[model samples]
Target: MLKFAKYFFIVFLITAILPLVLMFAWNNSQMEKFHNAMAKSAMSTGLMRLEYSVKTNLKVQEGDILRKLYYILPNDKNLSHIKNILNDYNTEVIQKPIKTPVSFYERKNFDLYCVTLVPFDNSTKGLKISKPVSLDLLRPTGPYTIELRFNKDDAAYEFKNVAFDPMAFGPPKKIFLLLSRVAKPHYKENSRREIALKGEDNSNAAYLTIELAFGPFRGMIDSIFTSLIILLVGILSSFVIGLIIKRVFVTPVMALSKAADQVKKGNLNFKLDASSKIEIIKNLYENFNDMILNLQTKEKLRESFISNLTHDLRTPLVSQSQSLEFISQKFKEIGLTNEYELAESLAKNNEHLLKMVNLILDSYSFDPEKLKLSIEKADLYEIIEDCKEQLKPLLAEKNIEFVNNIYKGGTLIEADLFQIKRVFINLLSNAIDNTSGENKYIKAAARFEDEEVLITIEDNGNGIAKEDLKFIFDRYYSGKSLERKLGSGFGLSVCQKLIDMHNGQITVESEINKYTKFIITLPLSQHPGKGTKEQP
Candidate 1:
């Protein structure tokens, strides 16, 4: 059953949790993809809008510069060489008119450079400007905008761009390095799509190029709350499902198991109510009830047979005892010791038979419901002596002496005389039987303690085996050396039962091949009445 429950839990977890786990995994992967897609989409859309905004700044404007540079271009041989190259420049120095007619040289690439000379203007007289004009003021643009220039010279690219910041979600923002990695600049046509990265080139024009940096999006579905919600739902659902299974299946099976244990212990008088809606459980209960009914019926039949047999046998045993007593009387009148000894043997046999019949009835009917003890006040000393006399034939046969060491004056004890006498007879008889081959002596003695009478019966005979001593008084139990004189195999059990009836105890101490002692403790003033009574 334990193994079954473990398997049930394992299977339940697997079935219940598997789909949730897969769903969570899929959801997580999709969320990551979505975050990336949103980042690119947002970047592309924002960059397009931003470029239009930069274009609409309304700050930079183109103007004619030919008249200002006409003398320098037509006369100077160095500037006349690349007239088209010189024409492309929107030169602020010529328009703003700075001191010394500042000559600017741009490295086209390698040792080749585009050097242009702007001599004094043809129309304007030679004059140096009073104040220095800021180059940034001449060419205006926004903070995010960057402009780069390229030439066919030693230096391929002229650095004119500013660095971008890292990505940040809120105030106290940090630089966004999301699209800040520097890669070899390549031109691609403007197209809106999800990309691995985000950045823009306003035009493919050479010499001067404008770049706009955009970033990836951070989206909502990639949050910790989504995964947390999924995890919590999965765990809670698994536990709830487990509990439902336990209540519906495991609990009922365990209860059914408990019922089986009671039946195993031979208790047939129990009511098992497996009144469940489950079909199998209902059928199991039905079969259990039937088994109990069958057992009860068979037990009744067996008890009835034994009860009738014991009752009928007792009558004939009484007649035989009478006949034997009559023969013994005749032999005694003849003063024949030899014949009297034989008579004693016959009498012993008869007594043994009677004891057997009574033991059989006691063994069968000894439950609390059927047990009745005929209580009375009797002398302990007389009971013990009578028990010894009852076994004299067997004692003589084995040449075993019976010593009655009980107090000379009788001690009045409250007990069931019949039951108590049987206990003494059985113990002494057992001692005599065991001592037969060894030619040993049997001693019976008694004394009074503060509140109990302790009677000790011991024999110098092959004692009970050590392993057998513990269960020697259990019903139907026999020691290996027991003589089976009572033939019913319940003599010691009956002895124990009778002593218990008087609110007393019986114990045995023994050593193999040495001696065995039976100690019976009876209350000195056990109030004389049946402690309990019932009908079989």
Candidate 2:
């Protein structure tokens, strides 16, 4: 049980640790991917914000003052009047703009405006204002023209004479600033743009630098820490679970191991007190008990075999020795020239010895491989006939009636002919020996069924007991008492082994004091590869 527990612990340890390691590795890889995506998104959002700030500030500077004026005006002007008013305002604002003084601080209040004009009549619509507009207004009627205008010192300037170009701003700040911010020692020329818009009096420029702040690093760290904490908790939980399992399952198994060791050392009385809650441990306990029972049975059989062997050997020896003594005494009483009587005594002793030796040899040769058989295609009826002929003298002596019921077409079977003949002879002899009553009879029959031949040998003898029938084919297992005139207990066992070698089977049916039947079935000249008819 302890050994099993140790192995289980090792398995649990490996199972628990491997997944955590894999999770940690996977977490690291996923973290890297997440961090990369966050970084890219942050960079993109930052760039978009920078562009939006520039456009928004420029629009605010341009529209704030003009929108106020447009809201104040009443809608009373014709197309020509509106154009002239816008043209006059543009000239006034641009021409008088020297009052505010262009400077870096004041540039925040500056603006640019763009306008597109559409004609009320839809004719002569190609005319667009050529000048860049800080603020633009449209005339509401006729083939109208777009006008760019801006305010300075409560006066508006309109650039009516200038032509509009899409790139008329001349790099934005250069047209408006008076000085370059990059000319300062602390300013980086490539890192930010600097411009000076030329004016009649002064110019101003401010650097617009692009800088990126690390936003996702903190988020990345937080995610990593969270993942690590989750993984740690999972690993700890798994370890605790594994430990609990080992205690509940492994401990009982270890107990079984110690008990098994005691059993191996011949301590059959050893018992395990381990908890039976575990199915494996309970199964082990049952198997251990069964093994002990089998061992005890084997020990009893060994003792019986030894006693039987001794008795059998002693019987033959005593018979031979007594016969020799009787012969010597008879010879003295009769004459030295009595050759016939001397020969009879000698033959009787030799026969007893031969019978004992043959029984011993038969027991040894009951092994299936040891009995080499000459197998061939032989007629089942012919073998049966031969066996009957050989047992005819014995039948006559015992006054036993013999009946043979062989099929019309002799059943042909592929088998070891010599071994099968021995089988038939043994069965017949066993029946003859056991037969009693004045009308003692034996019956042998063969019939074909479903591509196989079934042979049955039955006799009107004292039938086998129900208990003994189960073990009739066991080695040295004679159903009859030892005192009976039966040969060695190997006959049925040998027959069973021989039949098994030919891929055949034998069965028996018997009733006490009525009859005993031995049924043998063999494939009729059919190999295993050859298909047989299905039995109904």
Candidate 3:
């Protein structure tokens, strides 16, 4: 399920976020292209307008020169050369100039530029101009109009016929380079066009060429900022969507998984707390709760049935055991040889049966309330001796040696005497069952360790395998051995439970074909709050 959630998150992010990212990239590219094209167009339009204005100013200047020559001194021989130049101007005058010679003429809105002007042959004298005119005084109408201020030292200079050197203007404005970059191939220096002005005779035409400087538009979109914002929004949206998905789907499934684990570990009382908004998950949680409840009911019924059945079978088996013992005694008294042997054999079999029945009742009919301990100071050495004496018949049958290494006086411990004795009996019985070959021996030892008594039961006969040690005390987990298989597999589980009631620990260690040892540690005295009904 965790893998499924991860897979789902990856697939969802791809589907929800991939297309948006692609679209943003493509749109940003297209927008950049469009903005560049628009900037180029704007630059071209600026250049065209500059060129048209320069041409119009040049025509006006030519008309003013011609009017001064044709009407002001039409027949003056000294200015006849000027008339001849006016006749060769090769352009119609668009502006109406005064018939009389104007003292000073200033056309501040003119945009045409030239390094030198040749109005006529060398015989004609040039017109006088004022000192130091600003270069920007020529073109005053445009999106970007530059006014070049004259320095104090430059104001001493003068020009002829309003003509000035282009060098004195210095380098062009910084904006021209930016404009050129944006326009590129469309607005280069070579693209500048010269206008031809012709007279009525259409001969000896004068030419006007002007350098055009385009203006820049610094209004391009900020694609980086926009892309960042798009990316941020995309991430935030994906996170919100992913969170919703996990909350609505993944969380409930994880809860169900945890609850299922608890149930697998034999905890039927665990209930899932699923409050899902999704309908299907809600139904699933409800069904899971119902299943657990049903199992609990059936488990209780099965336990009750086992309890009643064990009780019913225990009564008859106990009675049969007593009757068989009496019949064996009576047959022995008559000394009916073969019949007496049969009775003894029957008595042995009946005794074994009775033990099996009692084991079932003790193991299966477990009620925690009825299994409370009778906590008191008990003699540990006495318990070990009693277990040994009770299993003496089996020890004699197998010819196995029993070694008790406890201090003879007695070792005292706070525990339930009956449960502690049962623990020892179970450990010894297990040791005896596994120790069957020649030179078989069982050893019991105890010692004081801090505030606890450490007791061990060891057997020298074919020891338990290394792999079976961990599960030796688990319910119904008898090891793989011929003698181990002969009895019901609940003895060690019962021993472990009884030890836990005394707040003690039981552990086992073994090596294949060497020896098996069961170690038990019990507190010398129970804790202050521990009582007969203490819960472990």
Candidate 3 weakest lDDT stretch, 10 residues: 107-116
Q: Pick by lDDT: which candidate is best? A: 3
**Predicted candidate 3 versus true structure: per-residue lDDT over 357-434, tens digit per residue:** 677778876544466676777677787888889999999989999999998766888887777887788777767777
TM-score of each: 0.42, 0.38, 0.51
Model 2 CA deviation exceeding 4 Å by range: 1-353, 370-372, 407-409, 480-488, 526-536
lDDT of 1 by residue, 231-348 (tens): 7788898999789879877987877777777665446697577587888878887888888888889978988999899999989998999998989989999998799889878987
- How high a TM-score does candidate 3 get? 0.51
Lowest summed lDDT window (length 10), candidate 2:
182-191
* Residue 102's lDDT in candidate 2: 22
lDDT at position 436, candidate 1:
65
lDDT of 1 at 270: 70
Sort the candidates on TM-score, descending order.
Answer: 3, 1, 2
Cα lDDT, all candidates: 0.60, 0.57, 0.62
